[model samples]
Target: MADAPRSTPGREITTGERRRKAWANWSGAVRGIADSLLSPATTDELREIVLDDAARARGIGVVGSGHSYADLVAPAGRTLLDLRHHRGIDTVDPAAMTVTVRAGTTMRELNQELAAAGYALPNQSAIDEQTVAGVVATATHGSSPGLGTLSSHVVAARVLTADGRVRTVTRDDPELDGVRVHLGCLGVVLDLTFTVVPGHRLRKVVHRKPLPEVLADLGAFRDVHFGGFWWYPHTSQAIVWEASPTDEPPTPPPARPGALLSLLCNNSWTPRIAGAAHYAAAVAAGRGGARVLRRDDALLHHLPPPVQGTEYSVPFDRAADAIRALVGEVRRGGLRVSAPVDVRFTAADTGWLSPSRQSPTCHIGVTHPVSAHDPQGWIAPLRAADSVLWEFDGRPHWAKVHFRTGRELASRYPEWDRFQELRRTWDPDGVFLGAHLRRLFEH
Candidate 1:
C-alpha cells in the first residue's frame, strides 16, 4: 500500500479569519477547527501537558506530516498537537543494528540520516512524507512479500498513555502488537526504536506488458526482492516494476539539466493537456533499462497531481480473481478513472489490526486527481469496487479512504476485540478516541 504522493500543493491550509484556527488536511479532503493548537518541544514538555487535566478533556490528537487521507488526524473540536519541530535522531547502534528517533521525524529526514550513518531500512515506502508515528500507526507497507509493514520493524517504543505515565513497550510486551498499528488511539507515542539494515543498493528493472497478462500470472515475480505493477485504466498496457538486492555498484539516474522543468512537464504540464502526450510517451518507451538506488529511494515514485487514493488487501492466492472481479465491476458500473491502478504486495504481519495480518497479501490502490467539475466522482467507483473486493475478503488500508465501519469490519480481524480492549486500557477516559476514531474502533 505504499504509493508515494508528495505533500499537498500548499500544505495544510488554515481557515478562520479571526485567528486562522481551522485547518485543512494535505489533500484538502478533511477540514476542521481545532479548539487549540499545542507544540511541545521535548518529551518532558509533552508529558507535562499530558499531566495537566486540560489535555484529557480536550481530547488531544497529534498531527503528523499531513500525509494521511483519512480523518485520523482531524482534531475538529479537540486539541491539535504539532510535532514537526520536535524531531531529530536520538541514537544509532551499529552493533545492534537499531536506530532510535524522535516520533516527529519524517521518513525523508530519517532516511537521509540513516544513509549518512551507513544504515538503512531494508525496504522503501512509496511515500515517506509521514512521521514515524503516523506511518507506523496506519501500518504503511513496502513492496515485498518477504518484508512486512514498516511498523513490523519497530522493536521498542516509549508512549505517553492516558494514565499520565511514560511507558516503555518492547517486543516482550503484549501491548507492543497493539502499539504497532492502533491508529494513534493507544496514546501519544513519544519515540520508537527500529531494527535497521546495512546500507544497501537495489537494482530495479522495468517491463511493460498487457494488464490481463500480468494479472493472470502475478505470482511469477513474487520472489523478487520488491515488485509491483501499475495498470492504466481503459488501456491494455501495464508496467511491471521489480527491484532486487544488488551488490553491484550503484548506478543512479543521470543528473539531467533542467530537472525541475522536466518534472513540471510530467506532473503539471502533462495532466493539463489531457495526458495525451504522457500516454504517448509511456506507450512509445521501451524497457526504460535498469537503475540502482539506495533502499530509501528504490520504490519512491514521481509526484502526481493532488489526488484521492484508497486501497484494499486480498489474500495473495485470491488476488488475481479479486482484481479481475474489480475490473469487471468498474466496467459494468461505467466509472471512469484517468489515473492508473497501482497494485503492490507485502508479507503478512503480526499487528493486531493490520489489513495483511495472518496472510501474505496483495494491495490494490486506486487514485484520481481532484476534479473541480465533479469533486466526489471517485467515490462511486471505489464503493462499487469495494463490493467486488469484499467478496475476496478484502481489508481496506486504514490510512486510505474507505467506507466501512467497525461493525462491518469486526469479523475480518482476529484480534479486533483485543485491540479495542487495549484501547480502553490505554485511554479509558477517551482522551484519544475522538469522533473519527470512535466511528472506526467503536461504532
Candidate 2:
C-alpha cells in the first residue's frame, strides 16, 4: 500500500548523513535538527512513509534537494523525507514536446537529458540545483521575452495530499493553476509533466552602458534579445544584453568554473576564518573576465550556494525611476553594496499570479553575498525602497525575501480568491501551511 499501515520506530541516521542533509543553495539558518533523513525512490514508498508518520505522530516534512530559505524544513524536531533518491525523468513525448519527471529531478540533470534529445525547458530560474518540484512549487522563473514563470509550463502533476492521497491534475484541469505555485500546501508534488522546447545555442554579448540610455531603448533591444538586463547595486553600470539561436548543436563537456566561484563566495566560515587568504586567492585567479558565455542551459542559470535574495517587479515604464530611487536610498543610508542587484525584463504571461501578469515588467533582484560580512543593516535600505516599489504596483518574488504580508498580497493579485478556493478543496486540513505561506496567502 502507498500509505503505511503500521507504526515503526524512527530510522537512525549518522551525523555525517545529517551534515549532508543541509541545503545546497540556501544558508544553514533554516536547517532542522532531524533524527533521520530518509530518501525514498518511488511514489508508493513515499506515500507509505507519509502515512506511517501521520499515524505515529512523527511530524514529517518533504525536502527537495533543499533549495529554498525560510524554516519550511526547520522541523524544530521531526522526521525529514529528502527526495534526492527519487530523482529521474519518467517520460517524454517528443511529438507533443512535453515530459513527465519525478519531483526530485534536478534542473541540471533535466537539461542534460533534454539536450541529448534536442529539447529543453522554455525558461529556467537563475540557479539550477533546485529540484523540478521545488522550482515549480515556488513558481521559479527566468527572463523570457514573452512567457511567465516555470509553473506556466506545468501541464500536469501528481501531488501527495495531506491525507496521503495522490491526486493527478493538469493545466486543463480545474485545480491546475492553484497547485503549480502551491508552496507544498496542496501536499508533496510527487511528479510533474510539462512542456519542453527544442534546444538552442545562446550568443552572449556583454557590454557596459549607462542605465538611462538603456531604458530609452528597452523596447528596441527586447525585440531582438532573448535576455536583457542591467546590473545593480552597482547601478552606475549595466550588463547590456545576450541573444541565443534556437538550434541543436553538439553537446559540450561538463564545466565547473562558475560552480567553484559559487563555493568560494557562499562559504560563511571560509571568509570569516580564512579572511584575506580567501580574497588573495580570488585576486590571483584574475578578476578581469566578465563575458559569461555558455550553452542555452548553462548561460541563464547559476549554482551559488544559498545566500539571501530579494526581488521585486514593477511596471516596465517605472523600472528606471524605481532603480534610481532604490540606489539613491542605499547610498544615502551608507549601506555597503556587495552583490550586484540584477535587473531583467519579461513580458506578461497567461498565469494569473505571475509577477508579470498583465503588463511587461522590469524585475529588480537584490542578492547578498553569503560570505561572512555584516548584512543585518543592509535589510533596512532595501526595506525603504520596498515601500516605494509597493506604491508603484510592484510585486515581490515569491521565492525571494520581502517584508510584505498576506493582507497586502491579496490587493496585488486579483486571482487571489480563486486560488484560495482551490487550496481549500485540495488541502482542507491546511497540513502543508507554514509561517511563510500563512503570511503570503492565508491571512
Candidate 3:
C-alpha cells in the first residue's frame, strides 16, 4: 500500500496554523475566527502595528474585500490586517495607460473612478467584490481571449514590509515578478499601479448551444472576440457565449432585482432553496443566455454574489478533454453542482506565478450551492476527485477551494521559492506569517 502524502511543515509548524481549523472564511466554512480584526488606513501605520503585534504573536493576515472563501485569509488566533480603510486611487496616467490605487479599493470602486476618467482595467475577474490588492495578490482573472489575468496588468506596487518600512517596486525591477502575486506573505500590498485601456462602450452577446460544437470551434470563436462559456451539469448543452465590444458604448445589462431578492431570501431563510430555484431555472430553460451592452466598467466585472467555488486553470490544449472528464466525474460522483461550470481563456504573461504563466489557458470553475442540509461527509466523495485537476497540470485558483497543501502549492508555482525568499527577507520575524500564509508557503 502507498504511504499517505506527508503533511507539509507549514501545516503544523506554527501554533496559529493549528488553531486555524476553527476559523470561519467568507463561505461560512467556519474555522478559528481571529481574536481581533485590525483596520489600518496607511502603509506606515500598518507596518508599525504589525511589528508591534508580532512581538507577542507573530501570526498575521492581510485581507482585501474578503471575496475568497478558501482559507486564503483565515488566520487562527492572529491579527487580521483589514485594508479597507486604506482605499484610495493615487494616480492615473492616460499616456502611460496606467493607474495607481490603494490596496483596499474594490474593483467596483476602482472601475467607477476609472470610468469617470475615461480609463479602465484591461482585464478584470468576474466579481467586483474583490479588492484591487487582493485580486492582484492572488492573480484573479476573468474570461477573455488572449488576455492575461488582473495581476498581469500590474506595472508597479508599494509594499509594507515587516520591519515597518515601505518599498515601491516596478515591473522592470528584478523583484517585480515575485511581488505580482505575493499572497500577502511577502509583504502587505500597499498600492499597485497597473496598465489600463481607454474606457469604451461594450456590447455582450450571450447564447446557448451544444457543448461539442462550442468546444470544437472555441479557438476560432475566441479569435473573434472576448468571451467564454458556462456549462450546466446533467446536460450536454451549454450557455455558449458572451462577447464584449472593443469600441461600443457603455450599456450595462438589466439589473436582476428579482434574482437579488431571491438570493437575499436564500441567505435569510433556506440557502439551498435559493440555489435550487436558480438551478432549476437554468436547467428548465435548457440554457438562459442574454447579451447586454454596458460601459467597460460594467462589462469587465459584475457577477452577482456566488456562494463559493473551486476554479482550475488547465492549458488550453487540454481544456476540452479535462472539462468533459470533469463533467463525467460530477455525474459519476453524484455531486449536486448547482453553479454553472465557468470557462474562460487567457494568453500567457510574464508574471512568475500567474496561472497564465507563459501559456494560453482556460479556467474551469465548479461550484456547489451552500446548504444547511448537507454535511461535510457528503462532500467527501467529490473532494476525492479534485486530483483530476492536478492530473491535467491544473493550478487551483488561490482564492478558491482545494485540498492541496504547501508542497503541492510549491510545485505548482514556479516562483514559489522567490516568494518565500522575499517573505523571509522582508519579514524575518514572521510578522506577516499566519495560518493561511503558512498553509500556502511556510512549509
Candidate 4:
C-alpha cells in the first residue's frame, strides 16, 4: 500500500515503485541491500507511510547523500525512504534572515540557492555533498570557535513521529534540543528552518609551520576566525589555513597554477588528487600567500578524496595532549597511514547528542583516503586512536568511524539519559528506527 506514493507536484516519481535496491555509502565502508525503496515526495505521504500497517511492520529507514563513513544509513531489508526527490527551498524570508528548507535538500543545492537569494549559511562542513538533514542529524560542525554546530542554526523543525502525528518543534519546546540532532531516531524530519546571514567572502591565508611548534601552543591558533590546519605528522610539518571574514574585493583565480591544482580538481582520481595536492602544498609552503573565496567555497577545504576517517571532539584545553597521545598510539599499534590529520575547533552547543555538547571543543580527525581501495586498512588505526581520545574525554562524531556502543558512550555524553527517554517516549514501536540504529541506541 505504501508503494504508490506520488510527488508533491502531483506527478508520480519513477523510483517510487517498489524494487530491490542496493545501498552503499561513499568509500564503500558500509553497505546493504533494501527490499523496497520509496521516495515520499511530501509530508502527507511520509505520514501515510508511517501510519501504514504494512510499512510499519516492515520498518523504515532514510538515506540522503550516503556520505557517512559509519554504517548509519545502510537500510538493509527495511523500506528505505530515498529523500532526493523531496528537496528544495520551501521558503526564504530575507527580512527575517532565515530559510525554510525541505529535509532532503543537499548543502550544495541549498548553498547555491542561498547565494542567489543574497544569503548564506553561517558556516558549512568540509564537504557539501551531505543533505542539510544529514548535517543536522550528525551534528556537523566547522572550525570556527565562534560558530556552533549546524544543528545550532536550526530555529525550528517539522517532524513526523511514530504516533502518526506531525509535530512542529520550535525554540520554546522542551524537546527542541532532542530534535536538533535526532540521529534518525526521534522521527522522520519533514523540513527545518535555519537562521542565515548576509552573503560574504573570506580571505584564506596559508602558512607552513613545523608540527612540533604547533603542538607547543595549539591555543594560539584556536582563535583564528574561520580556519584550521592540515597536519602531516610524518613530515613533521603542518599546512596552516587561516580564513577570516572580509569585505575586500575578491582575488583573481589562484595566482599560481600550483595553488589552483592544490585547491580545486576533478574528483575522478582520489589518490592522485591527494598526492598532487600534497606536492603542491609542500612546494607552496611558507610562501605565506593569501586568496579570497566565497563564503561557501572558503568553508570547504580539501578532504582527501575517497575518505574513510574517524573524528573525536575533545576538550579544547587537552586537545594538544590528545593529539600527541593519538600519534603515539598509532605508532605503538604500528598502523600505517598517510592521510593528513585534520584539526579544527568548535564552540559549545545544547544538542543532547552533539559531540561538542557543553564544551568548547577541539576536533581531531584522522583519515586514511588510500584505504578507500582497501577498507581493511582503516580498522587498525581507528581502533588505535579510540583509547587515547576517550582518555581525554573525546566524543566521537556520530557519522564517522568510531568503536563506541551505546552503553560504552552513555557515560561520556551528559544528556545521554535524557535522549534515551525522549526516543522511548516518541517512537515506542520503533517504526522509524531500523536494525542498524537499534544496535546503536538499544544495545
Candidate 5:
C-alpha cells in the first residue's frame, strides 16, 4: 500500500525561490511581485505561518487556482499563501446530503467525486477551474432564476482568521452570511460543507431568435430550470440556452458547432475574420436544437479564448431595458465588439455582499478578444456599456473588472458597513489586506 500525500508545516521558502516562481493569473492580466510564497500543508502549519511575529506586519494573502481575471490575489511585497497543494474531500454525510471538501479543491475535481458518491452540486458555473474558496469568496454564479449563487449553498465553513484562530461557522451563525463572500479579507478558508442533491441529468436546448422577440416574453425564459442567452449586437440575433431536468439515460455529448470557425475567431491574427464568421453563423442558425447529457456534463462548457471584460448585475425587471440601452450605446458609439453579450439570470440570495442579495438579478457581461494591434480598442465600448448598466442600478461582480470605488460600491450594497465591521473584527491588523481590497474598504 502507498501513503497518501498529506500537508506538513515547514520553514518558509527562500526569497530567491519565491522570485524565481513569479505568478500570473489565468488571463495574464495581473502579475505578482511578492516577498515570499508559502504553501502550508496542514491547518496548524498555516496558522503558524500566518501568526509568525515577523511576517504579521508584512501582510499575507491567499491564492487559489488564480482563475480570477481580477486583481484579488495579487498583493505586492506580501506573502502569498498558495493552497493548491492542500486539496481533496474530507468527509461526506450521505444521510444529510452534504459533503465537506478542502477549500483548495477545484469544481472539476469535486464534481467527479460527487458523482462517484451518487450526489452533485445543485448548480454550478460554466467554467470549473476555480477553487471552492475562490468561487464562494467571489460569489460566482450560474444562470437560473431558481438557483442562487455558489456561496448561498454553503452550509458550514472552517476558517483560519487573521489573528491565528480557527473558527467553524454554520448556517445558524450570524456571521455566516458575511463570511460566505469574505473576499479573503476576514480569514483563510480551510474547508467548506455544501448541501447537495442526488445525481440527475439535464436536457439542454440552444436556439437563435430576434432579440426583441425573446425580451417580449422574458418570463418564458426565466421559468426554466436554467436559462441564458448570448446577444450578437452586429447581427441582432440571440443564441438562447435553456436546460431542464431529464429522466432519460445519459448520452454522449454532441459536438459543438463551428469548431474551426471558433478557433479562427478566437485567434489574435484573424479577429475580424472570426467576427464575420460568427455573425454569419448566427444568421444561418435561425433556430437551434437540443441535446441531453449528465448534470455535470451539461453544466460545464469549453473554456473560451482569453477575454478582458466587465459584468454587472441589474434588477431582473430591468434586464430587457438595460440590454436595449447598452446595445444602443454600443451601436451609436461604433464599437467593434467581436464577442456576444452574455446575459444570465439568478435568484436572490442571503449573502451580505452578494450582488443578487435579496433581489432577483440579471447579469450582463461584455467581452472582446485581446488585441495586440489595437490593444485599447475594447475599452471605449466597455465603458460606454458600463455607463448604461450603471444607470439601471447595476452591481459589479466582485471577481470581474469594474471602475467602482468604495463609496460607489458602499452606496449600492446596504450591508456594506456591516461587512466592513466584520472585516475589521476578524483582521484588525490588516494581515490579509491587499491593494485592491484597500481600494474598496479604506475609502
Candidate 6:
C-alpha cells in the first residue's frame, strides 16, 4: 500500500488520519469543505505530494490568493495545494528585461521589486493581491487597447505535471499558449517568467459626463494609452478615467468616499440607502480632477467592498451596443444594483483560453454588495446582463461569476479543443480536476 499523505513538511499522517476544513472564496460567494490542505515550500516537496499514490487516488486542486468570486477554487472533499508559502523573486535578468518569480508571489510584491530594479509590468489589474499564477491562470487584465491580459506577458513557465515531472514551457512552445491560462487544470505552476519594461509614471484624469456622450466617442477612449469608465445605474452620469504616460512628479490620488458610502449602502439597517449612496457618489465624481502618479500607483485602485458579480468580454465594436442593451434590460427588470457597472478594454492576445483572443475586446462588469435582506435580488440583473452579452458572443471572465457550461464555453473559445488536449496530456488521471472544472471541461 502507498504511504499516507503528509499535511506539512517532514511530517506524515497515519493512514487512518484524515483532516477536513471549510474553505470559502474572498467574497464568500462559494464555499465548501476541503478534505486536506497542503502547503509545499519547495518544488521537490510539491512533486512528492503530486506523486503520492494515496493522494492521487483522491483529487487534488491548487488554491492561490482565493480572490476569485467563482467556484474555481472551491474544493469538495479534495486536497488543496496552497502555494502561499512558495513565493519570492527567483531570478531577474535585467538585460533580457525578464523576471522569474515563484508562482505564489503577489502582484504588489512583484511590482515593488521591479520598481526597485527600475522595471515594471506593462499592464496591471485593479487589485494587486492576487498571486502571479492566479492572475495569469484567469487571464486577469486591465483597461488599455495597447496591452493584453497578464497571461500575455508570460514568456515562460515551469509547471509540475500530474505525473511528478516539471515541464518548462517557453513562448515558442505551442503548448505554452494553452498553459498560459491553464485555469488550474493543466498542473501546478511552479514559477513563471514575465517580460518587463522600464518603470514610468502615469497621469490619471477623472471626469463625469453623460453616458451617451462617452459611448458616442468610444474611439476617443481607445486612442488613449489606458481608458475606462464607471456607470452608475439609474442615472445618466458616468465617471470616465483616462491615463497616459507622463514625466512630471507624482501627485497623490484624490480621497475616495467609496468606503463610507459602500458601508451605508450594504448595511441592513435600510436597504434603499444603498441606491441613494450610489447616486450621491456618482454626482460627486462628476466634478473633474486629475492625478499624476507612478505607473503602479495609478494602475492599482482601491479595493471595493465585499461584492459578487460577473464580467463579460465582447468584441470592441459591439461593446456600446451590449452595454446599452444591458442597461435597458436592468431598467425593465427594475433590479437594484448597488455598485457601478465597470467598463474597460484590452488588446487581443494569443493565450488559447483568453477572453480577448483574436480581437480587441471590451470588458463590462456589474457588481452588487451582498444584501442582508434580499440576497438573491442581484441575481436577476446579473442574469439579464449575461443574456445580453451572450447575444453579442461575449465570453465570461474565468475568475468571475458565470453560468456557462463546457458545451456553451467550448463554442466561445476557438482553441477549446487544443486546451483540452494539453490538459489531458499534463493531467491524464484528472489529478487537478475540481468541481468547477469538471462542470466546465467534462460536462
TM-scores of the candidates in the order shown: 0.89, 0.82, 0.85, 0.89, 0.92, 0.93
Give lDDT per model, in order: 0.76, 0.64, 0.68, 0.78, 0.80, 0.82
Per residue, candidate 5 scores C-alpha lDDT tens digits across 1-443 of 01322122434545554433366777666777766677777888889878775566667788878877678886576677888667989998988888999999999899999988888888888788999999999999987789889889999999999888999999889899998898988889999999998888889888888888888877775688987888876556788888888888776786664666465334433335545666776764435578787787787666777667788999899988998887777567455556777888899999999999988999998876656666665566567666778899899888877877889999999999999999999899888888898988999
Give me the candidate number with maximum TM-score: 6
Query: At residue 195, what lDDT does model 5 achieve?
Result: 91
User: Residue 321 in candidate 4 has what lDDT?
Assistant: 93
lDDT of 2 by residue, 1-443 (tens): 22443353333334554443333336643544543466666667767766665522545566666666544554533456677766789889988899999888998888888878778888777777889988887667776666667887989999887677889997668678777676666677888998998776655555566556766676664564466664434234555655566334434433454654554433333223333333432442233233433344544644545466677878888887777777666556443344446777777754556677677778887655553455453465456656756777899877666788888988998888888777777667555565457556757
Error of 1 at 140 (Å): 0.2
Q: Candidate 4, which segments miss by more than 4 Å at Cα?
A: 1-20, 252-281, 284-288, 331-333, 370-373
Candidate 2, residue 202: the lDDT equals: 58
From the highest lDDT down, the ranking of the candidates is 6, 5, 4, 1, 3, 2
Encode model 4's per-residue lDDT on 279-379: one tens digit a residue.
Answer: 55555655758888888888786545566778999989989999888667545545434566789989999999999888989899887653444658767
Lowest lDDT sum, 10 consecutive residues, model 3, at 4-13
List candidate 5 stretches off by more than 4 Å.
Answer: 1-19, 256-259, 263-275, 283-288, 372-378
Supply the TM-score for candidate 4: 0.89
Q: Give the number of the best model, judged by lDDT.
A: 6
Counted clashes in each candidate structure: 1, 5, 14, 0, 0, 1
As for candidate 5, its clashing pairs are none
Error of 1 at 131 (Å): 0.8
lDDT of 1 by residue, 1-443 (tens): 01222211112324454445476677676779776666666666666656556556667788787777778876687666777666989999888899999899998899999999888886767877879988999989988888888888999999888777888999999888888896888888888999999888889887778879998788885787898987755555677888887888888673342443333223312232424533543464324568898877877876555677778888899999987876675556444455667889989889998888989999988765665676776576666666677788889888888888888888899999999898888788888886877887767
- As a whole number from 0 to 100, the lDDT of residue 126 in candidate 3 is 73
